[model samples]
Target: MSSAEGNLTWEPATRHTELLAGPVARAIAATPSARVAPIDAELADTAAFCAAYDVAMESSANCVVVAGKRGGEVRYAAVLVLASMRADINGAVRRHLDVRKISFAPMDQAVELTGMEFGGITPIGLPADWPVLVDEAVVAAGDVVIGSGIRGSKVLVPASELATLATAEVLPLSL
Candidate 1:
């Protein structure tokens, strides 16, 4: 993966946060090419981080947690889309999950289940059974910035590497 630019310092993602030290870290480590950079927690939001770090918005990706119920069973998913587009949660996600309805996960539930902060939820450390829907546009972008499972840092990795995740599915998930 390409190195992050601006005032950030690149390092193994595992070293940045406890959230990234488990399966998240393992996934990145297995890639052999991923890199993560530490940033001020205050700038973790996509817009602020991109502006402060001099990174283009198109180079960043957002991971959103979605929840849906089917046959009285609740299921969760993490949807990765470029900052430039919105995830089609109502259509694409609902259909993919085979549920009658779907919506953005509640902040408390998401944070609790994923062990991530409200805005720092990344696809990396999510529950193994949760599907990670990656937008085709994001996968085509090559190098992209993503959450580090914590607000204190961000990960720079190849979109292709994210596609390799067992729970990840690259598709037209954006509207």
Candidate 2:
């Protein structure tokens, strides 16, 4: 539970996928209409991973983060982008966040905060205080597939479900 769960620690599954398997997996599981599956961990690239597994690009939500200053505050904003669409970080995001100077957080910081390896930082399992900026496309589509805090695992979830799970703010993600 830590602070959020009142000092409770879940019995985590040893498998990378299992960490999210319990919660995220169960959420999608409730919807009998949706199909749930995982691709081989060997496949890492987006196009290859999607094609090999028959997963659509738009259904894949990429979680990206940037570091910079907003007024007197130093901050980090997490972004949810479609695997197919680019994040207009310097355009829509910069203006919206009112960040005077914005740049991608170094890989080290990313690993430190999220406790997940690079290329596996999903909105799930992030620090409770960090803002999970939900992309409009993701929310509009109603569901997304993102890294599950593990390189070899992913979770499929509805945007609304994710909003509640991460305590995220569903808003305009980018240009």
Candidate 3:
């Protein structure tokens, strides 16, 4: 089954593995509710993709990788927030991670570790140990659009489904 949302046509992501990064494709294959849609790679960023597709900002979610350091150990996590809000990295996240300092992970590090493109990292296929911190608002937003682990396409899934990921923790993570 297929349908159109905004200006994009959506199909089961399992049918478009070529458009997803390896891990993401595998995750989607196991997630029955996820759908995929192709888009111009140049418009993959949240702002550009939302505008070009005529999608509401509140209906889009962004996944950000963050690094927190405590003494000699460093922890990495994926934070999910609505495109209309910002993640509370300095306060809630830093405290939650129990680290001395926390910041957005370097682009190269995030890309290298997640095995996904810089601008298209999604929380679905992150390293098994990484916490997937999802903002409460995002989980309450019903269906939302997110990166597909590749710049040429996007995934649509129920916000609540994200909260069900093994590593996910729904919290007040946004400011």
Candidate 1 per-residue C-alpha lDDT over 8-65 given as tens digits, one digit per residue, 9 for 90 to 100: 6666654554535344665556455566777788988988999898777788899999
* lDDT ranking of the models: 3, 1, 2
Q: Which residue pairs collide, candidate 3?
A: none
Give the candidates in order of TM-score, highest first.
3, 1, 2
**Runs in model 2 lying further than 4 Å from the true structure:** 1-38
Residue 54's lDDT in candidate 2: 61
Clashes of each: 0, 2, 0
Q: Over all chains combined, what TM-score does candidate 3 have?
A: 0.96
lDDT of 2 by residue, 1-175 (tens): 1111111122222223354433334333333223233445676456666676566787777888787697679777788878878877887777767888888899999888777767767776666667777777887765566765556655555666666654577777655
TM-score for each predicted model, relative to the true structure:
0.90, 0.74, 0.96
How well does candidate 2 match the true structure in TM-score terms?
0.74
Q: Candidate 1 local accuracy as lDDT?
A: 0.81
Looking at model 2, report the run of 10 residues with the lowest lDDT sum: 1-10
Worst lDDT 10-window in candidate 1: 1-10
